[model samples]
Target chain A: MILNIPFSDIVFYFVAVFMVLLSIAAVSSKNVLRSAIFLIASFLGTAILYLLLKAEFMAMAQIMLYVGGVVVFIIFAILLTSHLGENKLSTPISQKFLAVFLALTLLGVMAKFLFNTKELSESITQKSPEASSLIAYGERLLSYAPNGFVLPFEIISILLFMTLVVAITIAKKDNKEEK
Target chain B: MLPSVTHPIGDFVRENVPNVLGYLPDFIQPYIPSAEIATLINIIICMVAIAVVGIAPVPVLIYMERKVCAHIQCRLGPMRLGPHGVLQLVADIAKLLFKEVYAPKGADKFLFYLAPIFVLTAPFLNLCVIPFDKNLQVADLSVAIPFILAMNGFGILSTLLGGWASNNKYSLISSLRSGAQIISYEISFAMILLLVVMLAGSASLGEITASQSGHFWDWWIFKAPVLGLLAFIMFLVSSTAELNRAPFDIAEAEQELTGGFHTEYNGMAFAMFYLAEYINLFTTSCIATVCFLGGYHAPTIGILAIDNILNFVPGIVWFLGKTFFVVWIYMMFRWTFVRPRVDQLMALEWKFLLPVNLLLLIFGVVFLAFGWILP
Candidate 1:
């Protein structure tokens, strides 16, 4: 029997494999900066997967926010904390066997859960009939209806505002102390 | 055969290729999938065309910049290099191509090589969305504005990677500055673009252009009058900062950074950065043209006779003319303004442009809500 797979599924698997590899590299990299760069690669791979899923807006947002904003912020933090030229940046593996055992057990549990979830497989196989246009996405995001994201959106905005305020206050306090 | 060609340029080229290919003999034509071949051929042709169009103007733009600066400074510029330095860019390109490529001892070899490719790809990818004529755009994605912004955002990585990979202090500092500067200005830039998107009622470039069609009064700049003008100015300022042009060019401030993020780049690698910059300049100008300057539409101040006459001129002409005009203005700004300090640059965006853009966005939403926009 011949195996039948859609083009999008092929793209999805390709991106997923790369994303997983990049994620592992990101975590396992000895250099902090290299780890951050690897994280960017993983984020980009996820963005491609989003594209394959036909979520163009989400894909672009992923790139714009993750690869652009968060990754750059992480890189900046890495630069600030570490001497980039120095090679002795890796952490010592204090409990290597215990860590490996825990990681393997967690992976196994996740695999078992994933395989056992019938609803998850069903959802994966059945593509959504209606693809929301960008305008509809915007409307739904701002709407106050039952399924609308207005509350969460507003909450996120307020959270961001509060974070900004706290950060500014802390920075100002530091400047004052220095003075 | 190709489902009724909408793009005149694409159609014309598509028609000519197969005819030309026909002379290659029966074997080649038979092997080709005749129905799907036009699209495949068109895609290749467009790729080549966009690359050519993107790069071909660099030398001319560079020459124009030098001459403009020279005239501004009351001096002769490249008088010997073929008719007021027309061939100067050619000579410069040759010099750059032959210049030795070098990497510092501590540089990350892989990333060091990759940075220039990133720089070059961003603007080239951006060139695809710009609607030159009614159907001339390569890809008319609905989220053209966001796509362009995202591509540009990715460009910051190249600077960051270039700086980090170079392992040079100055380069690192410049890259950090660029990263910070780009991210900060991007907020205001996106806000301004959102205002256009809101006003146009669609995110597609073609749709925005279509809405602004007919007369000069129909153009967004003149349609909404005060709000339109304000948005245009805000977009210009934010986009200028986004492009890292003066007075927002502290990232690569020559006096201090000595070439900034690309301080370690040499030869063709350096040229790639330079090429990307100019291409970016063009792309930004083109966006401004499409979003604000009524794109390819001829200006018609409600005069029927004048409008008819204007209609006789093809759209590509108007589009290129308007885009170049904006490009010229950007060039003028580069020579005219002094560079702002880094603090001033950040302050300008966070303090002034951001608030103004937010207010403009609010006003645009309100106008759009009430149907006060022009038809």
Candidate 2:
């Protein structure tokens, strides 16, 4: 029997495999800065997966916020704090062993849950609607309906504004104190 | 199913490639699947086209920069290489490519090598979404505007990584400055882009251009009168700062940072950074043209006769003409203005541009909602 595979399936598997591998590398890398850079690679892999899933808006947002904003911020912090040539950044072997064990156990549990869910949902999967457009996502986000995200969106915005305000106030106070 | 070739240039090339391939032996031809061959050829052609658009103009732009600067300073520039020293850039490129690729002992070898690749890729990827002419775009993703923003945003990583990997004080400081400056200006830049998207009621670059089609007056810069004009100016200013072009180029202030984030880079790696910068400048200018200048559209003042005459000219020519005009304006700014100090650059973004941009965005939203924009 011949196996006929679609192009998208190939891309999906490629991205998925890379995403998992990069995520592990991101967590396991010795150098903190290198780890941060690896995290960006992981983020990019995830973005590609999003693209393969045909969620272009989410893919771009993933790159913009995760790779562009968060990862850069992480790199900045790493650069400002770490000594580049020093070998002091690596974790102890015992801690590394613990991390690997915990990761494997979590993966096992997730795999079990995923299989069970897949078995349960296989019958109903075809009834699921297609992914909504970005416009629909926006409308849903701003909607005040029963399942709307308006409150969460507003709360998040307010929280962000407060963080900005507090950050500026603290920075200004530091400047004044220095003066 | 065969993909319909919509672009004139693409169609011309597509029609010719199979004929060229047909001349090869039957054994060689049968070895390659027809579908795969076509797809491969198309991909190659696309990459070449994009590279030509992104990289081919760098030499000319560099020449223009030197000439413009020299003329401004009342000195003749590059009169030796070719006519008016046009080949000067060619010589410089050749020299740079052959020059030794160097890394300081303290540099992070991996990042030091990877930084230039990232820097070069960012601008080239960003070029994919630009509607060069109607149907000439490589991809017209529905989220093209955000995609462009995201790709351009990733450019900061190159500078940051390059500086960090160099292990030089000057490079580190400049990279930090670049990171901060780019992030700060991106807010205002995004605001301006959002204003444009709202006006057009679409985030797709092609759709945005389509909405603005018709007379010169229909261009977004003039479509909403005061608000559109302000948004254009805001976009121009913010984008200039975003690109780290002077007078906002504190990141690469020669006296302060030596060669800036790329201080340790030499030879082809340095050339990559230079090429990326020029390509980015070109992309920004192209985006500005597309967003505000009605893209490749000819100015039609509703006069049918003149409009007909104007339409005789193909769109790609108009696109290039308008884009170069914007590029010239940017070149003028580089030579004409003094570089701003870092503090002043921050203040300009935070104290002035941000507030003004936010206000302009509100105005734009209201106007758009009220259907007050020009037809």
Task: Please name the candidate that would achieve the greatest TM-score relative to the true structure.
Answer: 2
Candidate 2, B3-39: lDDT as tens digits:
2336766566657767877888986775444444556
Clashes of each: 0, 1
Q: What is candidate 2's TM-score for chain A?
A: 0.79
Q: TM per model?
A: 0.87, 0.90
- In terms of lDDT, model 2 sits at 0.83
Model 1 chain B lDDT-worst window of ten: B1-10
Off by over 4 Å in 1: A1-4, A91-94, A116-130, A158-179, B1-43
lDDT of 1 by residue, B246-302 (tens): 778888998998889999999999999999999998889899999999998988777
- Top candidate, metric lDDT: 2
Task: Give model 1's docking category.
Answer: acceptable
Lowest summed lDDT across 10 adjacent residues in model 1 chain A is found at A121-130
- DockQ score for model 1, please? 0.29
